[model samples]
Target chain A: MRGYTSDKDGYLTRLRRIEGQIRGPQRMVENDEYCIDVLTQIAAATKALQSVSLGLMDEHLKHCVAEAIAVGGDTADAKVREASEAIARLVRS
Target chain B: MRGYTSDKDGYLTRLRRIEGQIRGPQRMVENDEYCIDVLTQIAAATKALQSVSLGLMDEHLKHCVAEAIAVGGDTADAKVREASEAIARLVRS
Candidate 1:
């Protein structure tokens, strides 16, 4: 999350928009909109959120993980494990 | 994100906390804290975000997808595909 701080605002903005995207689908459902249309919107919103997660993961690797591995030790090992687990959780979700 | 609006505040609160958690690691990195420590914090933050995604997914299944399937048709097929792809993306992440 090194560069994350610098880009935090951008990320937050996108996530906020994503929240709206998600809300759009819910509203559609409430209005008894076509199920297919609602589902498609939900899919789009979900993908948008996933992109944020991917962006964070990229920054994490480029900064944190790389630095840890460079200064190899228990810390390095732990960083690797932490990242893998994070990826696993994302996949499982 | 059906019930998501009803519980939006709670979800937003948790996401904000996770944002702080991520910020913590960035600060740690800036301060040259141990790499393991920073990575661990990132892991926690990542997991927290994943939980949010899972909660959304669960609500989606129980509400949107369930309703679509109940009114089976092209919408049902689309809804199932949409959800499966979402799970796939999560797994790929």
Candidate 2:
């Protein structure tokens, strides 16, 4: 089971909100809104997405990584490595 | 007219795609997907949003901001200030 399984509903709610947020900029563009205004909406959506990422990362470390480390073996090392790479990708993105 | 007027279609298309991209994560969460996989999708959507912001910023600088600066007055200063703040928000987010 996934680390976020416990909070699946919460994550789904946030993601759905973000999906709606993205459409805000689309409507602004269709109406020829000012560039800065459209940009502001986009920035808001981007921040929302980032918040979700951070939340998921926290959950992953707390659950998945924690469980793997408890096992203490090659699996643990691979999990740590995989998580670090995922984090790097999150930071760069 | 907005700076992105020329590329309105492009911007709309990109925004629409991003809207769809956000749904990928929502579905993943609903299906109890791994935290890392869900995060990867979220990161992709965030990157796509950032790309759209950069494109809009480029257009703003080239057109709305440029035209305002050409006029050389208080409006120009305000426009520049607004654009700078927007850029700062983008960077922080």
Candidate 3:
């Protein structure tokens, strides 16, 4: 099964929550809620999103990267570079 | 259907390529490939990973976020905040 399949329930739940969280800001804008409050909510949503991304990245490294390495040869090196670049991008993001 | 479902094939192909890319760095380490070359490969992988993230984020905002806002009420503001925070985290990362 795909890594995603294993985490489907959790991922969907998080996404649903995120969906709700996103609505918060839109409503705030519609109602003209306090700027700080809206901004704070935005920040929270961002963190939540980052958490999701981090989780996925971790899984990718452990599964896909590890699998590639096990296969050996040029593929191993390719996997390592792929994982490293992914990490770099995550850090940059 | 989930957004991921629609992109399943593309995602898997990208992941497979990334898996190969990651191996490149590992082989470089084992074989003592040039540090510069390894680092360059790593950078490429990072960009590729970022591209994936950006695509996903875009989909999230368009589908889940938009759907939540359409429902209206407190949920709308919540979603807005969630999305903003996610973006902020991505930027920070």
Candidate 4:
């Protein structure tokens, strides 16, 4: 949380770039671009998205999760459940 | 990016919960808990991780990637490349 303010700007900047990537395919679709080309763009967008997620997950583990373990309280169990549920959703997706 | 500040607090809280969940398995391992239990916890942690990644990815598509396409510049190509590389890493990982 302490570092949140410091990192927020960079995170948002990266996200904005990613948002543009996501929209590329939609535009392609609207223009009736080649099937393979649109699919390729879609694939690219998906990967870009996964990258952002990976970075966030890494931060969460290092900061929030690590802190919870250090503190050792009810928060610990809640964190575990929260993480587990998140993983389940990812795999399903 | 504008929405970043608005959502920051909620995101941090969720991340903290995930952080605690990640450490649960580590503790279980250190305490010599049941083998199945440890593995189960590890699996849970992984799932939680995936969930966090998925959520962030979803947001990136909605925000960052989407916005880039709207702007229509060299950023468009850069965004596509950035996204593609990220996906490649995820699939490999």
Q: What is the lDDT of residue A24 in candidate 3?
A: 66
What TM-score does each prediction get for chain A alone? 0.90, 0.97, 0.87, 0.83
Q: List the DockQ of the predictions in order.
A: 0.10, 0.92, 0.04, 0.03
lDDT of 3 by residue, B43-83 (tens): 55545545655665676677767777899999889978877
Candidate 2 vs candidate 4: the TM-score winner is 2
Given candidate 2, what's the lDDT at residue A86? 93
Clashes of each: 3, 0, 48, 24
What is residue B47's positional error in candidate 4, in angstroms?
A: 12
What docking grade does candidate 4 earn?
incorrect
Tell me the lDDT of model 4 at B28.
84
Backbone clash total, candidate 3: 48
Q: Where does candidate 4 chain A have its weakest 10-residue lDDT segment?
A: A83-92
Candidate 4 lDDT, tens digit per residue, A36-59? Answer: 998887788776676666566545
lDDT of model 2, residue A90: 93
Better of 2 and 3 by lDDT: 2
Per-residue accuracy of model 3 over A1-93 as CA lDDT, tens digit each: 333345645655664575465556556545544333544555555566557556666666676667778998998899788667766755664
* Stretches > 4 Å off in candidate 2: none
Query: Which run of 10 residues does model 3 chain A get worst, by summed lDDT?
Result: A29-38
